[model samples]
Target: MRRTTTGPRDLPPLGVQQAFRLPETADVVLPEGLRVVCLRSPSAPMIELVLRIPFLCATENDGATAEVLATTLLRGALGRGEEDVDTELARAGCSLGAVRRSDRIEISGSGPSAALETLVGVLADVLTGASHAGTEVDRARRRLAERLPLLRARPSTLAAEALRVHCRGDSPALRLIPAEAAVASVTADGVRALHRAAVVPAGAQLVLVGDLDPERTVALLAARLREWRSRRPVGTVVPRAPEHWQRPVRLVDRPGSVQSLIRLVSPAPARTDPRFAALSLANVVFGGSFSSRLLSNVRERGGYAYWAGSRFDDILEAMVIAVNADTATDTTVSAVAEIRAELRSMATKPVTDDELRVAGNYLLGASALAMSSQVGLATAVSTTIGFGLPPQWLESFSDEVRSVTGRQVRELAEEMFASATFTGVVLGDARLLAGPLGEHLDMVLA
Candidate 1:
């Protein structure tokens, strides 16, 4: 028999991982100020398109108009009825959608590579001449009004809206859920006016990825969107979660609720910041993953919550990290306390060497998996580009995570994850949880 020792065996050292590289992209700017980025990936014979326009709402009513505009944009355009648009897209085997957010309006499309020109032409027509018909506008308005109550009733939605209100005050851009009256007031004329003012090609980004010639694709877009122009500059800088305007912990009362939704928000470094990688890994160890300390303490050990986690929320040039937990009504305060304890521990102590290595490996692996698909890669590139970072950021992110030291993570955690740095909202039966939570947090009723 082979000799065996009682001493612990040392595992082999990890080998160096290959660097992640995205396909090379060709970029161009149209005379109308539209930026086009195209990459050739032959994984499939289909193309994905993402168009981003800086559409800002000046008030809640403007948000209503934007919502209606997005709904009706693909409904009809250029003398084409809704059915006509659909038929044309179906002929090209294409699918498209338009979404309006507080910061921007996004139009995404996918189709076979052979139909790229036709797909882009349809989108261009919609962009330049969307017919926000009265009937469609009314239908969309009714749908939104009907759905608003259901969405607002969700505890998670309640907590998120409360957090936004507390962090950003009453900024209309951050008002994701509009009031019923606002939705009822949306009209075709209002949507058309908002589209005219906001949906110009100036300062917009269009990313196309698939099995196509990048140069030819750029040329095609430049020619097709030549008329999709306006003198208006981009509007609405994405709203940042203000670090200075934070309020005391808010308790949104939900009578007779069985569970409490807790959300804590704190400022986080933007992706372009050098500290971003360190903070991301630290977050993974702290609460970003299933194996995070927050979950282990608050759920597995204390039995106060079913789930708890954290994530980075993006804004214009900044970011915020949110810690979330849902727990039994009676354990609400205990869960919150455990979350705070994890934060304190992360802030005060250096993560172990093993924790740092695991977090780094997880971060790198997750990034690769997220970008493995053509759609995922396109989205990653477009999002990074939209945030004013070079596409190379995605390529270098793995290396950055690999190089992050335990000390760096600890320092970043200290800088960002302190218990005192957070402002939050708790949605629970205030009659049952208010007294207990108030003692541990600076609590207020909402």
Candidate 2:
């Protein structure tokens, strides 16, 4: 666990006078090179461990590695069979989790103090033994075969994939990895090779929080990982994908659909940009929530769709604004027009002080609202470390957000949204969308 000495750089502005403030945690360094920021609180009977590895899609230039590595981790490991891991975990009533984000793979879950050993052992095996058995590969293939066709039926899911394809450019984010083609193409040796280099003990972190004795937790992790070993992650830069990954419009052509699927996207500000705070708040006013401009214009006022919202894909390198909805095919063009108008209004106009406060409060409030659990806090810390934001970033985030003025929000908005690199994807009857939508957008009619 890391020592909790606050550096001068770690001071946060005395922002919110409300909320249960998170404690200052120590940055824990392990025997190999694993780094973890741990916060130990013996306030409960269970301990939550969130392990964050720095190697991610950004590092490899291909986003699929993290997903592939995570999925392949269950076959066997460190002399313990897959059944042994499940039996041990069931005996202890413990849970394991794995998430792949832009910059890291976050492993998190919890169990009682008495169950910690079993949890540790299971993780050790998972990190060391993941075999790509032919049977397991076939099982994964069968699962994907069942799930892939279903994904094509959902608009929201398709739009998200489209956003990834647009933002990341021809990567597996849109296609899903290891592609059915790639997965079918996966060999035992290939999986073994990928695991040997990427799944090193040193390449992973084990974070212990809540009711954990720092000393004991450290000891357990050390013993469990003693033989896990470490290997330096391979580092090589991948050329940047093009800004416009696919064409502007990709009509998936789902005929006779009750609602037309609308996907509107364009790259936006990154999380680390100086104007990030403003962009964030600006986004709130744009489409971060139900109170956003898009919702107000496209839904409430224009009555375009059943639902609508925009999300920021901010992480290691890039970020984007994505909007989706299910509406009538005839309203598709009008909804897209309203969305652009809202984007332009945000960019060209200034927000009100009242608007700024509302956005700030919502953003900050939302953070504390969701993190009311130990698991949530663990996820927050993992992302914070993965993003490499300043130590006081969260502590000071409220103030930065509140301090943002209307002018700043408008300025940031204009800078980020000027190009209008809009992508309009309608995943319904392609014949219905034959009109002016493409003239204003980089349109690809499927």
Steric clashes per prediction: 0, 7
The count of residue-pair clashes in candidate 2 stands at 7
Residue-level lDDT of model 1, residues 1-446, one tens digit each, is: 89887889999876666678978689887888888999888899999999999876677787878888999999999999999999989999999999987678999989999898889999999999999999999999998888898988888777777777677766777777887888888888988888888898888999999998999999888888888977654255356547473568889899999999998888886787888889999899999887889888898989999899999985344478989999999898889888888889986666999999888777777788787778988898898889888778887888888888888888888878888888878999999988889888988988
Please list all clashing residue pairs in model 2, or write none if there are none. Answer: 2-26, 2-27, 2-28, 41-211, 76-129, 77-129, 249-444
lDDT, candidates in the order shown? 0.85, 0.66
Itemize residue pairs with steric clashes in candidate 1.
none
Predicted structure 2, TM vs. truth: 0.82
Per-candidate Cα RMSD to the true structure, in Å, reads 3.7, 8.7
Question: Highest TM-score, which number?
Answer: 1
Q: What lDDT score is found at residue 298 in candidate 2?
A: 90
lDDT value, residue 296 of candidate 2: 84
TM for candidate 1 is 0.93
User: Candidate 2 local accuracy as lDDT?
Assistant: 0.66
